[model samples]
Target: MSAPAPHGPAFSGRVGWGSRPAVLVVDLCRAYTEPDGPFALPDPGPAVEATSALVEAARASGRPVVWTAVRYAAGLADGGLFVRKVPALAAFAEDAPGDWGALTLEPGPGEPVVVKQYASAFSGTSLAATLHAAGVDTVVVAGVSTSGCVRATATDALTAGFRPQVVRQACADRSATLHDTNLADLDAKYADVVDLPEALAHL
Candidate 1:
């Protein structure tokens, strides 16, 4: 068989799954998943279903399962740059209906829920410390807006000395193009982007 022509410059490196792993579910809230919910995506069904599976695998393995949500203060004063860049962020303000921020996953007792005003779960949040305290050396990332929160969290995970593995089917975005593009980029340079089955096997 003939080798395919090369496309872009090779961006090489892999941060394989580490000994201790944690599942980080980012913003799979009603806002992004429910059709009538604020900040709703056209279709988050697949990602929601896939993430539920990841959560189950994590639980079965007894790994830490952490969740992240975006919530701005009553007036959006704390949102700052992020809100200004994406006005739709106002949907996450506290003044909005409670269901908007409701998580798709039914978090069990003692599961930590990290709240942030930015894309990265680690930004202005104790996520890294939480992971470190739990002795987690690898972060299994899954959630909404593949081009945004998932990507940001995965990138920051790498910077924080944790191997990030993004489950492709478990991360979503309003735009398929954006989702696929960012996943490709992440797989190339930042994280290991694997399918749902592979992610479960990793767990």
Candidate 2:
């Protein structure tokens, strides 16, 4: 038997990296990175290392870097239905012990950190305006849970009129299947999924 056809011809259009790009690190928090944490992935090291390289390359190129974290008020008053749906999010509550929501890759001076309650980094946040103010025409997306926050943020970035480039090696998920599936979807419809070297070159 032959394999199925790819998602091209219909969703083949590519929005290549623009002239001005900013690395958007989404939800690379301790909750997902720490092995003992509730939301830890099977293997977070590769994604973390790739994302760190992307961040470093962006900074060295003098490009802007934005970080996003999921934080909710005590009792999840700010998380809305998302918290109720995924109780694991309690790890990010303001009063949660050990600051589990803290970013694994700390933001540097002058770097903007956007705290959100939902999956998408651009949802209910100043991320669009921040990117606009920085003259960023493209978003180099990285971070945890490729099937969740990373996919959402990449879609929203495209919706907000910015080119979205999802670094394939810089995003992780609970499983390899989940990560690969979502990256394929994002590349077909919303973002251009590229490798770390390609992303670094763009930066």
RMSD over all Cα atoms, model 1: 1.7
Model 2, range 51-109, lDDT digits (tens) per residue? Answer: 99999999999999999988888988888899889989988988889889888988999
Kindly provide the TM-score of model 1 when superposed on the true structure, using C-alpha atoms: 0.94
Clashes of each: 0, 0
TM-score of each: 0.94, 0.96
Q: Provide the overall lDDT of each model, using Cα atoms, as 2-decimal numbers.
A: 0.89, 0.92
Candidate 2: what lDDT?
Answer: 0.92
Give per-residue CA lDDT, model 1, range 1-203, as digits (tens): 97743334566467888899889999989888888876678888888899999999999999999999888899998988889989888888989765588888789788999999999999989999999999999999999889899999999999999999999999888898999999988988899988889889878
